[model samples]
Target: MTHSQKHIIGLVFYPGMTSLDIVGPQQVFSALPGVQIHRIWKTLDPIKTDDGMIVLPDTTFENCPSLDVVCIGGGLKQQAIVDDPEVLEFFQKQGKTAKFITSVCGGSEFLAKAGLLEGYRAATHWAMRQQLMSHLGVEVGTERVVVDRNRITGGGVTAGIDFGLTIASILYGEDTAKIIQLLLEYNPAPPFDAGSPEKAGSELVNKAMLFIQEMSDLELASSVA
Candidate 1:
């Protein structure tokens, strides 16, 4: 595929977003020599991550084209859902035009509020799985990544790479995905065995629960506003 036909992929950056969730897949997808990838934000100015890293986006929300593919990642500032009408409107508009729409962790909530995930099977970080169901009223499953039609969803931070590869497989073909996985040397071996929610136990799960609780009001307000 030529550069123009490769697909325009956009990642929307927000405050408190999981750096890995957005960047990891971005790294993998952008590596496709043909794809044109960009980081977009509410503004074209440089934005900072929760960890104090600043990133300059390729474009602002007002000007970004109707993308071929777009991914939203979780962040601390989800209040934008209700607090920023422009963000919600932008998401709704993009969801309609984009060929594929996906999210990581809490990002799915935003999509749901925009009325994109209704009647679709989805997934999110182990922490937000239940919240996604309760708030969005969508049937969600437990998986590292779930691909249902054009809407792809995944668990937490590390899940982005898997999500990207999965989407690449669907869009470009299984062969292309395998080639990228091999080239990226993505053989993962972990010392801890806590990738699944069943094994994380209540304590670790509660910590994540508390964190989401703090953001709960934001989502509620966003949904209403």
Candidate 2:
């Protein structure tokens, strides 16, 4: 197959976003030749990550050019963005023309809030999966990476790497993706088998659920106040 001339991949950056969510994929996509990665936001100011690290935005919503792929990464402040009209409008506008609409972790909530994930199978952090289904009414998949047409999503935090590889394969080719993977030493052998709810058992799952619920409740309360 003939390659596309060039591809532009835009990643939505916002305050309190998960740094790894953006960095993981950013590293992968930016490694490929002829692929331009844009860190976009409402402004070109530095945005704080959930872990308190600050990242500077490379492009503003108004200044960003048309993109081939639009990716939104999740973070603690997802609810704030979900409720932002400007952010949602930006997504809606980009979704209309972008070749692929994707997200990682709670970023799927942003896409769903923008009305782009309707009737599409998407993935998000397992902790937020149930809330996403109940609140946004989108089909949530539990897989590490779920691709429905051009709407792709990654589960939880570290899944961003997997999501990146998937997008790489689509943009370039399987060989290119494999080479990138090798360069990154993308091999996993966890010390424990408690990564998922099934493997971690109900005790761990319930604890995590409670923590997520508490955070959500606090965010809602703050929003209402």
Candidate 3:
């Protein structure tokens, strides 16, 4: 699928952005020919991820060309994305003309914060599902991947690959995406089958509660509200 004008897909990164949130889905999108991927930021300075991955922006917020899709990666810095009204405004702008707009984990929450999910069914990692619904009034679901109109979403980090494939299929065709999947050998298996809440038992669920203690009280309160 070659368009004379490159279809640009932009991602916003900041301190603590999830590495997998950007890379996992990125591989899938980059696999497509003629689709350009860009690291977009408020500035052109070097950026870092939550897990110590250093990245350079391909473009800045003011200089970026029209986006075919704009996805915001999510992690601990999701609060920052939520706080930046300018970033949300950019999403709303690109989203209006973008052929498809989507997110992976808490990225869905960013989309909601941008006021782009109004009256649209969206999905995010189950952990942020409550916050997305509470702050943005958008319903969240537990699907591993979701496609409600032009908006696409997936569960946490692990679901990004699936999310990307679904987006590719929507853009090109099932044939194109399936071939790419086969080339990439996307068939996945896990040592443990406890990836999602449905697959995990109470013990795993309980252990996860311990990690929640690390999050700020504000996020927890908003999430629980």
Candidate 4:
């Protein structure tokens, strides 16, 4: 594809977003051919993630081009952006024409809040599923990756990789996506089998929830500090 013909993909950036949620998908998309990726935010200023990693925005909400794909990564700070009219309006506008509107982890909450996923079935971090249903009345999916029409969503943080590969297959082809997978050596051999609540059991799930709550508390404190 020519420079002008490259697919424009915008990844929304915000304070306290889970880095893996963005990075996993970004890595997959970055290796694809004829694609331009933009780290978009309300401004070009640097923002700190939930883990204190500083990320710089390459484009702003007002300056971003019409995107073929628009995605967001979820974090504790995602709740803050849900109510921001600027962000919601931006999504509302871009979403009208974007070929794919997607999110990872808690990012679906942002889209739901923007009134973009009202009739769509989406996936999000399992922990946040109830909140989405209760607060936003979103139809939640139990899969690691959910695709309803042009709206795609990934479960939790690490699921972003699977989500990206799914998009790649749709955009390019299964063969091309397989090639990218091989090039990235995207083989999984996780030592533990506790990736999901069903396998992790009640005790481990409870512990994980506590840890997540602690992280949320820290994020809240940092946001106000």
Candidate that would win on lDDT: 4
Question: Between which residue pairs do clashes occur in model 4?
Answer: none
Per-residue alpha-carbon lDDT of candidate 4 for residues 43-131, written as tens digits (9 for 90 to 100): 99999887789999999998899999999989877777778899889899999999999999999988998899999999999899999
Could you give candidate 3's per-residue lDDT for residues 1-225 as a string of tens digits? 453445678877776688898788788888887888888888888887877789888788788888887787678656756768778778878887887788888888878877778878877887788788886799887887888888887789978888888877877779878988998899998898988776797888767756755655655575679
| lDDT (tens digit, per residue) of candidate 1 on 26-58 | 878976758878798888787777566788888
Record all residue pairs in model 1 with backbone atoms less than 3 Å apart, i.e. clashing. Answer: 16-75, 16-76, 17-75, 81-222, 82-222
* lDDT per residue (tens digit) for residues 1-225 in model 2: 235568999999998788999899999987888888899999998898878898999999999898899998888777677789999999999999999999998999989989999999999988888878998899988899999999999998899999999999988899989999999999999999988887899999999889878877886787689
Off by over 4 Å in 1: 1-4, 80-83, 207-225
Model 4, residue 78: distance off in Å is: 1.9
lDDT at 194, model 2: 89
lDDT of each: 0.80, 0.90, 0.79, 0.90
What is the Cα root-mean-square deviation between model 1 and the actual structure?
Answer: 4.1
User: What is the C-alpha local distance difference test score of candidate 4?
Assistant: 0.90
Q: What ranges in model 2 sit over 4 Å off?
A: 1-4, 213-225
Q: Cα RMSD (Å) per model? A: 4.1, 2.4, 4.0, 1.9
Candidates, ranked, TM-score: 4, 2, 3, 1
